[model samples]
Target: MKPLLAWHQSLWQQVLASWQQDHLAHALLLCGPQGMGKAQFARNLAETILCETGQACGKCKACNLFKAETHPDLLQVEIGEKSKIITVDQIRNFIQYCTLTSSYGGYQIAILNPAEAMNNNAANSLLKLLEEPPAKTLIMLISHQPMALNATIRSRCQRLDFSRPDKKLTLAWLQNQLSSTQDAQLLLNLSAQAPLAALSLAQDIKKRGELFQSLNQLVTKKEDPIEIAQQWNKHNPKQILEWMNSWIMDMIRYSLTANSNSINNKDSIKTLQNFAKQFDLQALFKLLDLQTEAYRLITAQTNIKAQGLLETIAIAWHKN
Candidate 1:
């Protein structure tokens, strides 16, 4: 496996130690927020376990097959492009894969990312496999929201929690990755301190700035709700709503405490302050509630009418 991120070194050591001691769990749940690199870590562990040398030696047959994405012993199950849920069929196939011996006489590995994306039947099918895991098999379940998974499923696996990392180390690492100077702290705050998420936001600064500008125009009555909604709906609706949600939260924080430091969007502090002056606290709270509901609705149903929901949010902003 390639070297893990610095923050993951300690956990990697712990997991590697377990493997060396022959005490590694057959199933592991890697739980953390999105963009913390849990998926990458799980993949690395899988490679290590599957390699004949018990290390991810790039020259080894197993490593070569894994790098080519054709390793018979490695199975990765996730939601399909057209579907939000991992179906029972996928789980059934995974179970079948687990039942077989490894072709390389090494560990058979299965990685299920965003494990909560499994529907009830699919999860139940997986639960059965967990209940009677085959020997020399390892199942790595990566979850951004582990609480959404069934308690039984969670309990069945040994968990590797990746919830926290030292902020100073993360910021230093993020700064090194950028070619130009950037407000690493602001990006970190925007991403709830998830380093990879912060990096993604930093890379897309222009798009985020445009979204903030559009939101500002809506607040100033310079843009029509329907028109803005139409434009935003052309992009990712969920991301647009998430930005709006954060803005509303900032407005609320500034309104209550009059502290600019409390705001996540440091670049938009002045605009948020102006917005706070114009909109009442009640209206901001209502907008927040609406955004939360919109997020839930959009996430629950792929066919949801996001334009309508965005329009509703825009109208509310105009009204307030």
Candidate 2:
């Protein structure tokens, strides 16, 4: 298995200790924010558990099978690209797989990534499995928002929280991954201190810059809302909304505190300051409420018309 991130070393050791003592939980919830690498941690743990030597020896048959994505004993369930929710059918299949004996006579592992993506019926199906877990099985649920899951599911699984890490260690690790010229602190701030998210921003600087430029143009009345909406529709709506939310929050912070240093988007401070002065406090609150609802709708439903939502949000920005 690939090694866990440096910040996760202690947690990994703890899990190993539990396993060695035969006290490992049948169901584990790896809870953390997005981009915190919880899924990778889960995968590493699974590999170690499934390895014949319990060390994830890269040359072992089990390790080869796992790397090839053909491990008979490992099943993964997640929302498909065309669908927003993990359906009951997928959970049912996982249950069937659990009924079988492990091919390698080791652990039968199932990873449900973004576990909250499972619909009510799917979650209920999985809950039954959790209630009466099979022998030598490990069910790992990787969740960005554990609160979105059923309380019963949350209660059944032992949690491995990845929320907080030593800031100095994280910053040091982040610095090594980024180029010397990049501002690690600024990237961290933009990503809310999620290292992987910060790295992604650094890697996609051009796209991020373009997005900020579009927002600046919108705020200055230099671009049409409908046109920007059309352009953004081709990209991932969730990411678009996230960036917009961050920018709006920064603008609001500048308005309330008159402290540009406190804002997340330092690169866009001047633009935010100029825009913040023209926005009404009540209107800003209304926009925030609208964006929250938009995020809810996008997350809860499949095949949403994000263009219309973006256009509406854009028009709201222009008018404010």
Candidate 3:
């Protein structure tokens, strides 16, 4: 497969030169948030290393091996379906791969996506491989939570941190994908700077509508908060709350700027306008803060009712 469509131009330029010169390191750690395509970047790096006749020309024998899934030098450490943990046994198998001669006499590469999924023994096993890595072997660890990994494992690799693009770029990117004008700022608010989350939200219009409807009712009607929370908890609270937060922010933006494009709801602009006229910016900000804290609080606990969380969110908004 081809590399991801969007390349960080500056980073790609630097990496491409190093690959061409055969000066790249044996281990690289790609750090970024969820859905930021760090794993894809790691895959691209692996393809480049395994490519024959200069790096990443993409049409050589080695590249063909990769495409055919017959490359002797390539291995991947992903989560086990039911276990959800990378085991030491798996790492031991990877160690065996390290000892093999490359089919093309080129470099060997392994991509370990979400390195945090490694259990304690699995991580220590990996450290052993890192200690005496094969001369032609490379390890790429893709991580969203670097802080959760062992310190020694981190020290051995060159870490690359990828950040989210700004709203203007994200909006344009979304607009291009959907072939429709988008509310970038609104999406950004919902996604915590992760554009993929925004794109997902936009695609599920019916779910988004129900989420928005519940949020508006929660804000406007004195409904049972417990029932609301349980409903979202049964489905997906992350996406539901995210969608709610977006509409709430749009309401605030409409109140302050009368900016028509800031709202994500094309069919429910009337509701946005009504909420905008009713709520002030400071109040909206506090409500956002409350909703955010509620999300954090819910995730931190176990066996908690969605209604309780919903009540808490309502209280936060009602007070503000």
Highest lDDT scorer: 1
The candidate, 1 or 2, that scores higher on TM-score is 1
Which ranges of candidate 1 are over 4 A from the true structure?
none
The TM-scores, one per candidate, come to 0.96, 0.95, 0.70
Task: Give candidate 1's TM-score.
Answer: 0.96
Writing each residue's lDDT as its tens digit, candidate 1 over 1-320 gives: 77788788889999999999999999999998887889999988888888878788888888899899999999999888867777788888988999999887877889998899898998899899999999999999999999999999999999999888778788889988886668888888888788999898887888778888888888888988899888888888878888889999999999999999878888888888999889889999999999999999888786788888888988998887
| Cα distance off (Å), candidate 3, residue 243 | 5.6
Of candidate 2, the 10-residue stretch with the lowest lDDT total is: 203-212
User: Superposing all C-alpha atoms, what RMSD in Å does each candidate have to the true structure?
Assistant: 1.4, 1.6, 5.4
* Clash count, predicted structure 1: 0
Off by over 4 Å in 3: 1-4, 55-58, 81-83, 164-171, 218-230, 241-320
How far residue 33's Cα lies from its native spot in candidate 3, in Å, is 1.4
Return the lDDT, model 3, position 309.
66
For model 3, residues 63-110, the per-residue Cα lDDT tens digits are 787788777778988876545567778778877887777767777888
Ranking by TM-score: 1, 2, 3
In model 1, pairs of residues that clash are none
